[model samples]
Target chain A: MNMHTPLMSASPLVLSVEGLAKHFEMHHLNRTLFAFENVGFELREGEFILLKGENGAGKSTLLRTLYRSYLPRAGHAFYHTREGIIDLALAADVDIALLRRREIGFVTQFLQARPRVAAEELVAEPLRLAGTSYAQAIEEARRWLAAFGVKPELWAAYPSTFSGGEQQKVNLARALILPQRLLFLDEPTASLDRNARHALVSRLAELKAAGVAMIGVFHHPDDVADLIDREISLEVKTIADGENNVAE
Target chain B: MTPASSMNAALERQPPRLMLADPILTMTGIEKSFGDVRALRGVDVTVYPGEVLGIVGESGSGKSTLLRMMNLEDMPDRGEYHLALPGQEDLNLFTLDRFSRRMLRARHIGIVYQNPHLGLRMNNTSSGNVAERLLMAGERSFAVLRARAKESLDASEFPISRMDARPSELSGGMQQRVQLAKAIALEPALLLLDEPTTGLDVSVQALVLDTLKRLQRERRITMVIVSHDLGVIRTMADRVMVMRNGDVVEQGLADQIFQDPQHEYTQQLVHAKL
Candidate 1:
């Protein structure tokens, strides 16, 4: 067993999980698939944990589950919120929403681009939702976009028309623009170039210094080795193994 | 001061929570049916002050039925509808008598329909239509009626110079603006909009949406908007309720509904929009 110790043990604990498990039941095929089981971890403020796993190891699924996008089949994820500690796995929808709006930020590999909305406006949306005036949000969005190496001319263009790399940059800028206390990054550097990756690393370093706790899956872990405090690797479960494991 | 105590003080001084504010309208266990067709089946909704709640669904989804119930245009077969206006006792809308309902609608509620023809009298001038609503709400003075009409018209971004023109003489978007002006002329606490920009050109729709957004922000009026167009709902609503076949499949903050829909039906609706 790999001992999971926080690099900054003095910092406050932000999240604690135990016996977390999730599965999918394929009704048509009479099959049950296990994504991950008995996954547990502890994270503290300003700590960055690198989620290491091979393909289909349920790394992204774990992140999404913690974000309340997917419900867990068993176990508890106790999130220490400003209001108080709550079991995120069983928290009410409204409580989860409040947490998402204020504390948690998730960045997926693909950007679900809305048509006709400019890149800058799309990136500024989170700030606008948090009650910043439109003009100020746009100003901050422009600054972030420039920092991410998005050209000035493309800032006003629709992200749906942008290339994959461009879209990822915009997505990164949008999610990173706001200083969320906890962040979940699902292969955020998957499609970026060398320069763009460097920009993202520096931005993340700044966030770490500001005490933002994060869990991320990087395609190439070497790019962020300096930022990583610990690692949790998932063991991929095969179909044959899942067939014997009944979903509880 | 100790660091922990100072942090606690900072948390104490945090801004008042918006979500904790008292709701302006609450509908519980709402049910509606038309003969053999069940248009709504046990839905509950709550609207906070100054927030825009968007109801989105395909045709026959009961979204329109729910919006109509808010304005008392269509009564629900069973439900508890309560309105809490400032400086007034909480009123149970379902129990109000006919006369009281009419008075309540005229004084405190405003509705803008999909078709401008349904909302505006063709013969009345734009400002006249607005003044007529004000008059119904007991504003008798000619000067006050005209002033209120013009003020609301200007707020809706309808040209003051064109306030005298009839609805027929105005463009589709302008006519919708006139209806908006008329609806808001009384400065009602609740505004119900049913597809307020459905048939206009995209550019015109944008103009009307911008006007509505500004009006809601400037006046802080609580609004419930029903639209089949996801784009319109996305632009206008702070929160969204997704319905299908007389059942509310999902309700959440707009960003969540649009970005991470949970239910399968909601996922389909979002993907269709995408």
Candidate 2:
């Protein structure tokens, strides 16, 4: 058996992206944009991968494509679970809300435009979507926010009204509250200062210890030093030059 | 050069301490208290045009509060904040009327927040965020704003292609660079940066500092950058102000402040780091 076979049988990889590709028509350049081409990586159980790249280098684009905010024109993404390996690319689009609510959690730097749900409302969204009762969702929200180091006084405020740092914490709270297996962060530390960055890092480590696999696009190496287990570098050959095939 | 001059030169690699004939923003006997807790007491600073001033202090030392004072967001209960625009006008910012103060902040004062997202509009495109202050500054034409945004982004080496993506879709360094573009697009005479490079990685931090200095020189914009990284303060600050217990512990040129720190606190801070 190949090396991956046994490892998969024991502790399966939480997420894997193989030959992931997204091509968009860029009107400004009068050509199609290859956002990701043959981008291959595997995140084992509890593995933290820091996806590093500059702006326009497809960092946030890849995160969005992975979270299925935008559909990848071609290629594959899979989430390996106890049941079996589920094709994330298809699950991401077909069962978008359920997929996002059940297995995937994405924390954008600005938090997405999911509406100006109050602190309680937004935090409770995923679990409620997963069919949790309102009282249970609110209790979960309160507990998660406190666990994420957010103050109780700001619980009723809209995410739009909170400060950038506070809003990010709310995003983290919402994405992480449901105990999803795969977590994704795009520039999560962009708005956070040093102390807050440290606090989030420590919290992420705790979640990592609890067997949550995360894919993060990190800019500050120091802020992400202890969080990442692998680094992915992007070259033209990866996103422009096609090289690999999708694996089953 | 002789050995004496060589040693002297080695000791003082940069120029002597910053001395201006007149000050741009001066704080005298500024005292601020929050109920019973004294935040700032008898703190003073003298800032000049085209100068990079670094404010260094630890947590709870009221450095953040002092920066808030610069933006006039938080006012000192005692003392005066005298603002002078050389060759143009001189006025005490503390004495300005509400409309005058709003006008000054909207047009003259530009602040780069520690969290670029807080200062930037993330929902709109990058060009929209960049031209936001220009809209605030009464530049209403869409064409001119777009042109100005392109020019500012080009000047700072900001990736012009990302103009359509919202702040949510950019890297940390990219967002910070966008904030710089927004702040400098107005070409404000005074720029205040609060922990601008604290969270950035070392390489990105260097790039940001270089960009800050380059903009300060090209635009002749007076800068006050707050940071805890002494190396950052050393590289960018013309004059470094050390704050402790909500007061100015020491103030001098970067060389003097780093080499021979007079205050025990400053010396300790230096030793604690590198």
Which model scores highest in DockQ?
A: 1
lDDT of 1 by residue, A180-237 (tens): 8899989898879888899899999999999999998988988998899889999877
Q: Candidate 1: misplaced stretches above 4 Å? A: A1-7, A23-34, A109-125, A128-138, A153-164, A239-248, B1-19, B48-58, B87-89, B99-110, B127-165, B170-174, B177-191, B197-223, B228-245, B249-274
Tens digit of per-residue lDDT, candidate 2, span B129-240: 8888788889999999999998887777688988778888887778888888887887777788889887888778767776776565446588888887788788777678
Candidate of highest lDDT: 1
Alpha-carbon lDDT of model 1:
0.83
lDDT by residue for model 1 (B222-252), tens: 8999999999999888778889899877776
Candidate 2: residue pairs that collide:
none
With candidate 2 superimposed using the best TM-score fit, by how many Å does residue B268's alpha carbon deviate from the native? 0.6
